[model samples]
Target chain A: MSLAKRIIPCLDCDNGRVVKGVKFVDIRDAGDPVEISKRYCEQGADEITFLDITASTEDRGTTIHTVEAIASEVFIPLTVGGGIRTLQDIRDMLNAGADKVGINTSAVLNPEFVREAAERFGAQCIVVAIDAKCVSGPGEPKRWEIFTHGGRKPTGLDAIAWAQKMTAYGAGEILLTSMDRDGTKNGFDLDLTRAISDAVAVPVIASGGVGNLQHLVDGIKIGKADAVLAASIFHFGEYTIPQAKAFMREQGIEVR
Target chain B: MTHLAVIDYGMGNLHSVAKALEHVARRADLTFKISVSADPKVLQAADRLVFPGVGAMRDCMGEIRRLGIDEILREQIQHKPVLAICVGMQALMERSEENGGVECIGLFRGEVRRFAAGQHDAKGELLKVPHMGWSEVKQRAHPLWRGIPEGSRFYFVHSYYVQPHDSAEVVGVTDYPAPFCAALARDNIFAVQFHPEKSQDSGLQLLQNFLTWSGHA
Candidate 1:
């Protein structure tokens, strides 16, 4: 049998509670991160990702406690992203039972931090998160630039080139998020996903703009992403993970 | 109570492994006391052992040697049951190509090899290295495979795979463009490249079987 395409449910967490932001605005509370994660695990989610959106230092402590509580009970791969700036931050999350940590702003700021984190903690646990926004117009040559501060600022770095560089610097996986489509639910940026997926040798997880199970399939079939990450589709109980997997399986995409 | 020690060399997280064992042990018929330790005394006193690891081969071997777990593993494997996971399975080999070729504990006659770049599957699709995902594991006859079906999927995350010199030692295999040893077994030792702790239900079943295993084929 071949390796199954992964279905990961993204939980945007704030101070131990799950939240969702539409296009990085209009935040809404969901539930406890730990409780929601357990439900996702039970629903046959291949992995669970917690994006800690809490900006305050005091509230960050709650994220770790939330991770610890989930790790103690949930028997699945857990990835924590957002505000992972240092090796100590990565260590604290891992020690709190996170299987992987996503490095976005830190990697773009220093670039060397990716190499250092990989050297210290192995490439398997280091995931480079790239937030890309389409800079070129529809008729133009389809160019995308890396963005920081939750897709608010542009770094002028090419998304394809940055992905290749991160993998070369020892990133085991790439979390590709389409800033333009993030909460739009129009489906993933297929062209952008395919570009980054083909550019890097490591696995690429396609994030943003997933409204239905078909979007998940398109991410793997058309975008060629090794995995698909979604927030609202699963969070709002619009569809269960099993249903998504079944639909993907019917579409002939192997899923566990 | 049966004492189980999960050997920790500070290579990777042992929290999931310990927690998984505790979860399975709760409903088990036998009482279990699970501990995560690097101390020789604690390892030597355990009735069963779990060797879990992640990271570079050189660093893993370095910590294994520095902490004297190599000797403890060699001693404990003689009689008690032992289960190795991920890089821990790789460490049982004679050597590895990782970190520019490093020597391992030599419990099994094998060598670790990296997944060659530009490898393709049957569909002509380029297979990614590190093989990070859930893949179906084809099992052979073994106690740890009791509740797990013949081709159940398990979670795996690694760049290199073990190649035991003797085919008789391989208890499970998975295809990542090609068939590779996913699980190894002998009289008192059972090792796997996949993480049973993070593999959900099927993985939990394997660990539950491991807890009740008698160290026999």
Candidate 2:
């Protein structure tokens, strides 16, 4: 109730410029992160989330220049994630004007980091992102399984239960992403999103599989998500924020 | 120029609101500029001020105090058009139950309380918490909603709603359990529980009215 219906456009960056494609390929130079962020701000993006897709175990520093550049140019909130392992990384991101920090691989490997981040910088500043794929089965773990390292490795953990643990560890929000639906433009994994939302008390942002405005409405109305996150649809100029909200309004979903 | 100053103090959703205002101004053939900043000088030069929010009311008020915009808002509301949307509107109330308790801008004598619908209304009872969907705003006479139709739907994503001390200030009402105030206005001050920016035509027209009234058209 305290949170608004967020329309977040994620910028997946390798170095500085935005990139696209499944598993990060085609290597399209969308635009400068700062410039693209400014455009999104003008186009009505509630928040900007930058996933340093390249910042992995090998890479040490995040695209600090990109973060600083975009942070200096916009006024809305920004959340920086990817390769965030240590407290120093979180500190650097916050000092760079990031309102929130998202944890993926590290949090999955060491769940205590979530609790540490929450304790140091209020739980509101910490976001735990989960990339999950539905496992095919019945009594033998028929639930969604966690995928880490940008969907390169499967953690073999039930996503529903992991999300509950993350919340318990003091994650302010959950960025629940569907690896199966990601980059497919099919639709959000409503079943996956709802399962996670129903399990947590914090806000849940539904990511992946947003092809049209109806996808967003479905995410909010049926999925019961606090926000919806998409990439290519907003990046390729498929839908403007106003247009999406207008559509949601017609569909009876609370937006903005 | 109809310059709109979108107050910013580490709060999200200002850009989205500004974009909607900018789009409305363009459609209305009005020359308007929307700037997002916490600098006091920008506020001083603004013709209109819009406070947009998407977070806790307590935290928002804390940021407003941190930025020292509370007094500026009071002074500006007396002279120029001020629109408070979503949590922005909630911040205009006397208090809220967001984090146990918090005091807000006393622009209107009201308290924001969470929706208490235990059971689903469709299931022969009140609906659950976190009222999330489009609901009609029973429109009344207000400059901000001049051309918006009666029972026009606007996007609403909030669990708490305002109950104004003076019923006259309630310009729009919508039903959930009982009738609730969806929009409020008194003089230059305007507030809405629903997000007009996200309401499509009805929302666009409302923004157009604000732009036009601010002398942008």
Candidate 3:
């Protein structure tokens, strides 16, 4: 069977509000995360990911409620992340109708947490989110370093090496985000994405710096990512998921 | 009332499948009760059953054996409609090569084998393991495909695929690098390697079809 590269719409929910997300939609009231998600599913998004920037207890409840509401209507898979520290958090998200849960800082803190959760919940649902930025000297070789605490804390771990380790630890997928390209609207860091994808046997999702439809295609074409995750591009009605899929199909890339 | 019980051995996306069935119940205008249950009595009482599984086949079978899901499956398969997915489908085979050849429920006459690592497609591009993402499934005269179109994309994430001893039991085949069983059906049992719950509209349709189907095909 011809497996089409996936297109995922990421929702960045900050304190129950859509802050710095979706350039075209009004951020007030978080624009109803449930409603926004349903529209994307109708437009043929393969999956939806929700990131709670603050990840407070109150926001966690809100995220769970939002996931329930969206899960009731949306037929596709849903992934939720941000401040998911323990196994209980993953269980709560999955119980709240999330198909997958993304983990970042917690995994960096306790690398074994990846193996623990994957073993308990199955690696199929454990997504290790890597937020990375290129670090290099003028004459030295360049490499992407893993950043945690929402890209604030530099862990000094090589992104590519960490990806390989996470895979060995039983991570089903890697959500790799480029801190340098995020919100820049330039394009994805194809080199970084390709490196991690090449290093791991599991699927890698390319995030950050998606300006147009072509960037999405390039993620799969040049970066060799299994999926492309975007926020404002689809949030503000910049481009519907169907339009993006059509463009990718036109480029001889399979999209569903 | 139609009740669809999703067998829970503590793995896979049971809620997603339940939610999709709930949506299909409303959309199809059919009254239904969907439940995710580990209790044998609750599962045995349902009008239909959905066996959803994920993770490594070894652990999946471990929980299945621990919870006596195999016994329940055998008893229920004779009387009610049962739908299996992913590792749930894999576990129906006689054995699996994953985790050094784990024996399964022997419900279907087949063996599950791992896809060759470092395999490449016709284009010479490297084919990754786990086969994650959406793939088009070619239908083959199955009642579970009643309202769905042929060649519809279904989400797949697995390292091993089933190689049934009897090829006639295969209903849907998808070509990742080579043709393999994507779905199979016999008697009242219907199983698929793809995740219909995550496959969007077409997937919902498949669930709806399962909800309404009797144990005929």
Candidate 4:
């Protein structure tokens, strides 16, 4: 059972165009979401995630259209999040061709929403997106807190504990993002990623800190993440999905 | 035109499957027509049928009975070629242990069993359930496997594995740390636990073969 490590290129879309930023700020235009996603699929991306960064009520319709356009062309598994606050939004995303829905803010606000969504749809379709940042300082032991609203608000909940709760609540997968490493091009927070990966039984997709192919390999090899989701590098054409996959294959890591 | 229908019982993402079939058909330049419908008449008229499902076994079986899809599948399986994927394949068993226990269509003598808790690979590390990723499926010489190579990887996302009563009914096997049925074939019926639509190149080839198959060995 060689389950290939998945390489997912995340599209931070707002309105209709793909955007990129550092720690969920300084958003810049990348390209059309559909075109970029289609390119990634051709490049052997295992999956694609489209997050509607601008989660306004008015812009919700446009995001659905973009998800539809992308899914109509791209055959890979598509997960959509941002502004997905209710079961109806989840149903809309699935109807828009999303195979999974990532819930961050909503899941934190109403934990039972996760269980309800999973029961109504399926556990395979529910993805809990966790944006965490290390709060541990000098004398304090290691601790990470969950952040919501693009990392602007702290939930006072420990990231690891929340992940365990989310899993028990029926979240089939976890999209763990380190707010500090996001868009830094440094590397994934291997410690935090591994912590959550070890804490949960479901698949963990490490996101928010990839600069090169080696980082992609480390996300799985070191952090023990089941998948890696990256932006910027793939969006700007610095490295294609195939290039990263080749790097993983050379690293002796299975990728599809 | 060669008409194909993918059975839609409100349990799966049929759009992607339909799109993949259309893409493969266009690439192969075959005169194929495909649609995702729950109507029995549309399914009866098609040259081929695909039964695709996801979600819990209990809900899937509930919907199958609520819509009379069980009768449709049972009657059609005898004469026409049918393909099932994921939970669609699990529902083909006599019963599933999921949701405590759920009775299924009973088209075959097999029970869907959940992966024992705390499953691990050779490394002594625990393996996750829902087995969500691509795994190399070991083929067992079947007509539907026509052009697909041996040990080709296909996308799989499931927790329960089907245990067929007859070994010959198994057409392919994959290990989630242990060997289990990955693909099955019986007469005009061909079903896989993986999502060929999401699997890429080799997956498209398998779909192409199904389109051309004559429901005979």
TM-scores for the candidates: 0.97, 0.65, 0.94, 0.96
Candidate 4: Cα lDDT at B58? 83
Tell me the tens digit of each residue's lDDT in model 4 across A1-256.
Answer: 4788899999998768899988788988999988898888888888899888778333343378888788788877888988888878887787677888999888988999999998877788899999999999978878999998888888899999999999999899999999999999999999999999999999999998899999999999889999999999998889988888898999988776
Which regions of candidate 2 deviate over 4 angstroms?
A1-128, A134-143, A153-157, A165-175, A180-194, A197-256, B10-12, B18-23, B26-45, B116-136, B149-159, B174-180, B197-202, B214-217
Q: What Cα-based lDDT does every candidate model obtain?
A: 0.90, 0.78, 0.85, 0.87
Cα error of candidate 4 at position A147, Å: 1.0
What lDDT tens digits, residue by residue, belong to model 2 across residues B165-209? 999999889876668889888888788887776565677788778
Per-model RMSD to reference: 1.5, 6.7, 2.6, 1.6
Q: List the candidate 1 regions with Cα displacement exceeding 4 Å.
A: A55-62
Model 1 Cα lDDT, one tens digit per residue, A2-55: 999999999988766888888987888888888889999999999998887654
- Which of the two, 1 or 2, has more TM-score? 1
Q: Write down the C-alpha DockQ for each prediction.
A: 0.76, 0.06, 0.64, 0.62
Stretch of 10 with least lDDT, candidate 1 chain A: A54-63
Q: Give the DockQ ranking, best first.
A: 1, 3, 4, 2
Best by DockQ: 1
**TM-score for candidate 4:** 0.96
Q: How accurate is candidate 4 locally (lDDT)?
A: 0.87
lDDT (tens digit, per residue) of candidate 3 on A87-201 = 8888878877887888888889899999988877767788999989999767777698998765677899999999999999978899999988887778999989999989998
How would you order the candidates by lDDT, starting with the best?
A: 1, 4, 3, 2
Off by over 4 Å in 4: A56-62
Encode model 1's per-residue lDDT on B1-217: one tens digit a residue.
Answer: 8899999898777888888899999967669899899998899899899999877788899999999999989988988999999999999999999878999999999899999989988877889987999999999898899978789999998899999999999999999988999999999999999999999999889999888888967
Docking tier of model 4: it is: medium
Model 3 interface CAPRI class:
medium
